[model samples]
Target: MILKTKITLALALMVSPVMSSFATTFTKEFERSDGIHKVKIDIYEESNADTKNSKITASEYVKDKKVWSLVDYVNKCPLDINMALIKDSFEIKKINGSFDAVLFSYTIGCVGGLDPVTVKYFAYENGMKHSLRGEERMVTPDGVIDDNVKPVPDANLKNNVLLFKYMTSNWNKASTVILE
Candidate 1:
């Protein structure tokens, strides 16, 4: 389809080799505190020059103690590519006035009609630092970047309700998410 081809071309244009090395490793940290609950998060990313693959890992600590760790994601790009972490995307949100939560968002891109560098949000809760949306889950679906939908704060909205809107050159579509 025309839409698929356009997306492929857009993603291809975004590919860039960030570093020149046999293997590159980097870490980014973010910390949040509310006087009582303190949380620290570190994101580690490594890329291989030969295989053009990258792996991202995340560790979460609550009250200075490790609570959870995970392989956030892996990308196997056939060509040289870079997955840039959105540094300012880290945020803390209060869920239903109950507990504070953390959100980490990033973007990745590759060629051949993929998701096209869409923003991915991984959320974690307090205490045990368990995932608010489950392990390695993204708040947005494939092709749903920041521009596709607008988040509106509604007092009546249920905790489980997720509304998604798909915007394109041709038409706009809206739907509710049925989590798998």
Candidate 2:
């Protein structure tokens, strides 16, 4: 029994390092009302929890100068920020504050249906993150868009950045985003 236990432990240790490389975490921050907000995205190997990776991901928040009710993201490297990511729906989640009623979160599409992503923010007054506001022929990183039913943002995508910029800015004042 003692020998068997030692063997099992050895085997576990040997495989541990190999397991942690499959997960990833990505965070983006912006400002709203002069405050900072934060957005976090996590991607991992379906078979392993220890596998983690974090990189900067990008999506066109606006198309044809209009707001897309859907969320989109294209997996580039950890630094590139331009890519065409298609979207079928966006998962919206409401938090707190004045924007609570309409503010929500969601991601545009799936990682080819393998990786699921969700983005949340504040505003809208309905906490709706996936509702298509309207549809029209337009253009996006993915290509020429059709009547994509979405919302006419009372603000800009940069305004939407306020969704998480507040936190980043606050932290920066305390530590990094503003330190430099």
Best lDDT among the predictions, by candidate number: 1
Residue-wise C-alpha lDDT for candidate 1, range 66-112, written one tens digit per residue: 65565654456666443544554455666535655555545444544
lDDT of 2 at 100: 31
> Pick by TM-score: which candidate is best?
1
Candidate 2: where are CA atoms >4 Å away?
A: 1-21, 46-127, 131-180
Candidate 1 ranges with C-alpha deviation above 4 Å:
1-49, 112-115, 127-180
RMSD of 2: 14.7
TM-score of each: 0.44, 0.25
Return the TM-score for candidate 2, rounded to 2 decimals: 0.25
Scored by CA lDDT, what does every candidate get? 0.42, 0.33
**Residue 66, candidate 2: alpha-carbon lDDT:** 21
lDDT of 2 by residue, 1-180 (tens): 999999999999887754333444444444445344444444432223332233323221212232223333333223222121123112233334544322222223223322222222323322233222212233345555333233333343334455434322322122111111
